[model samples]
Target chain A: MAARKPIIGVMGPGRTEVHTEPVDKHVELALELGKQIAAHGWLLLTGGRNIGVMDAACRGAKSAGGTTIGILPGPDAMDISDAVDIPILTGLGSARDNINALSASVLVAVGMGPGTAAEVALALKARKPVVLLATNPEAEKFFSGLAPGLLHVAGDVEGAVTHVKGLLAAQQGGAAGGAEQQQQ
Target chain B: MAARKPIIGVMGPGRTEVHTEPVDKHVELALELGKQIAAHGWLLLTGGRNIGVMDAACRGAKSAGGTTIGILPGPDAMDISDAVDIPILTGLGSARDNINALSASVLVAVGMGPGTAAEVALALKARKPVVLLATNPEAEKFFSGLAPGLLHVAGDVEGAVTHVKGLLAAQQGGAAGGAEQQQQ
Candidate 1:
């Protein structure tokens, strides 16, 4: 394995606690995405909390032996999930640069809201690849008539992994050829 | 004012220190989203940094009289933009839950990386309206062929905002008088 893995961004909902009602499906989906990131030798980056999908994805990534990075907002916050490999406490001051936590090659968006969507655009501007899983009606409709080859829509974790693997293979091939040409 | 302003999430590249590099377009985009959020009475959420898109978004939101929130991720992190009203310092030791920074009704995605995508998925699971700007080949393929009306795909920030506004109007109208009448 390489010394570093790809950083995979997972976008979703915050303040999920307000929902009051539990959405069990999110946990499963989050875990699925986490597992995909881990299996593909990618790092998982998120908001660094223990509740809702954040906890689930962290657990999933850990179970798959992937390194998970947590970017916290302050020093006095509550405990994060047990899966975190790096706990970066930026204090209450650096709350806006969480996107910098993971310099990723690709980003996979799972269940998301406005906050999540903002991150999607952030990744795009950074020239990172982003994948969407289990999207909502609004997202689906908004993206209608878009080219499929560019977006990479996956409904499940397995598909997400496969899609990423394909992308990685292409990247590796390009790198290998360039290295060989340089040596020659 | 409407019961709720469509929340906009801003994510993008951030530098630890002010650099001599030319300003990026993301700065203007983030600020625009923030202004629209405030003008529409929607909340603005960000990573709470003083530079980059985070700072720009705060400026726009504040200028437009919007509600701005910032969530810092680390112990040594700097303070949020002056425009931020709610500064949440989540000292959780993970980067996976930054999405928790805001509970948005509508998500407008901006420039970011993998961490940003993670937030997008969380929002999807939460079933919030999503508007994605800057569709590339990867993103286009990642979100292709999904059910209509789930994702709102836009080519730029302006398009994204327009899409979200459409969603907000529909949602508000539905909430006003629907199968189940409720207030946003």
Candidate 2:
């Protein structure tokens, strides 16, 4: 059987005024991050909306031949973008953010907003690692005081991916050590 | 054969240090709001955690013999407070905020934080009436410039309840007028 790919969750704004421009830097960054995550032989998960950062990320992942999943807030497929390979129509609404937090081994926050902030908080509460790609000043300030081990702030997509890979390696090492201890 | 009762969603802090006091004013206020909502023959809904405003509101509603539904973030009933008569384990995590927003005709925001702010935004996006209790200065500032028709800022529990009742009446009136027009 093929090894199960690691799932990396992406959290960001669903709507933003920056989207009015022909090119949004945040979206571009998120797209590059998604591509990097996919290129690393991992699955990408997002809020699954057709607009904003989520859409850009999914699009990037698909462009790199990577699998992507969208955990939608509503039951209808109307809001989901074509970039998603699998659409989990939760019908649970924004509360589905919990699933997004819990389903991934690590979460990448591309931009800060109320929704994205909530996702980051939930990931922290769940004891999952969060990589903040700080594009927004408010989001950066929000996590400035957080304890260092679980949360890592990166200036760009490459820096964020490096952190994610390190965390994943550490997680595997811990799990293997635990297994050996159990055997002994 | 009876009419369906309106569901009023109460959004607030799930975890608070303010809970340590002999009597948390915020909790007390939430409790009173719950009682008022129940006394008005409405059903009350909350996030269903054992701490903070969600607990207080559920307790208040239960005290007044009001039916209370808790939309929990996880599948387990372990975190659900006894104040809730019905607990829905969505396991959707923070994403469940969308459910909390859409399940109610109107939502009362008791406090402001990332989670509560997300709820307020979802309610606004869904075009649902949102009553801000103005307990959190940041939350108040966030909604200060919102259009005045569906969003209302209330100074106290009584004021919040009054606004909710007025919105309910307006909604019913609008529905009735539409029905009358259809009959014509």
Candidate 3:
């Protein structure tokens, strides 16, 4: 029997709390990433927040009529995106980054920040592949050096989605991250 | 009533899976960090693994007759440290770093690695202070730049414990990470 639908985690910055303004490029990239993830018939996962990459991605996925699962930082539904169909509240605050990173078959980071970097690092630690989009060259270099095979730099959303598919296929072809595969 | 005893989480490389040989300095520092955390009348926390930093820290805490907790990556009691008084099986694999980062009053990273970097990043994302010991300068600079005042570079285990105490005091005095404070 086939395993459940692969959960693709989209991790990025939530500028509502950190930055005064939304990062337009990240929002744009994340929106496309969500659309691509949904178009592929994969499960889309993101942080259930009101603004920034999470909200934009959720919007894109919902626009495509795809189901989305959001991991909320607070216990109550404080600032969740309206598009999230399934909201998982951990009340773990920033530590909730772990849930976002661990739950995904592959994590696509559209932007770089303290939280997003943590998720990427955690995912790599579990031997999971992380596809980068719209992130700086410095971050790309640093993370790439840390995990040679697991880090993939993508030029755009389509490139990211392609790498995601390739990485997941690679995982299936080989017995990599035996414990991480059980996350779904 | 006052809050429960503060938990100091010790995070580092497991080494058994990733590396063949142990980094001696990290093991030595983590052992002392655990002892200092225990002696300060605070609780000790670590990954419930049999080798490397987790095991060494647990051993130090137990040696000092202190209460210790472990976050196990698997559901079953596999590769658990003998010194772990309370073992929480997460089955989260590398994502278990969130529990280690969030559950602590402060996290002391004895060494630098993919897993430890993620924990430090997660903790800082949640506005928790992290004390560093025996880590390379590049890792230190990277994390410090991300968190600013949240990062503390320690010369020794005793120094790390001091920073942990100071940071916790600052948290209580100020309203930093209000949501994170509710983690315990």
DockQ each candidate and list the results. Answer: 0.08, 0.22, 0.47
Residue A174, model 3, lDDT: 62
**Model 1 misplaced stretches (Cα beyond 4 Å):** A1-184, B1-6, B15-20, B75-79, B93-102, B144-148, B178-184
Which runs in model 3 stand beyond 4 Å of their true positions?
A1-6, A17-23, A39-41, A64-67, A74-78, A86-96, A172-184, B1-5, B16-23, B39-41, B75-77, B88-96, B168-184
For model 2, what is the alpha-carbon lDDT of residue A181? 51
Highest TM-score scorer: 3
The lDDT leader among the candidates is 3
Q: Write the per-residue lDDT of candidate 1 for residues A5-103, one digit (tens) a residue.
A: 667766565445412456566667888889878887788887666666667788889999888887665575576666777876666423333354235
lDDT of each: 0.63, 0.82, 0.84
- DockQ winner: 3
lDDT tens readout by residue for model 2, B1-184: 9769999999887776325878767788899999999999999999999888999998899999999999998889778988999999988677778888889989998866556766776677566899989555444544443334567889999999999999989888888787765464
TM-score of each: 0.49, 0.72, 0.79
Q: A30, model 2: CA deviation in Å?
A: 2.3
Pitting candidate 2 against candidate 3, the one with the higher lDDT is 3
| Residue range A1-184, candidate 2, lDDT tens digits | 9667899999898884325777777798888988998899999999998888899999999999999999998988888978999999998766778789899999999876656766776676666899989645444544443334687889999999999999999988888677765465
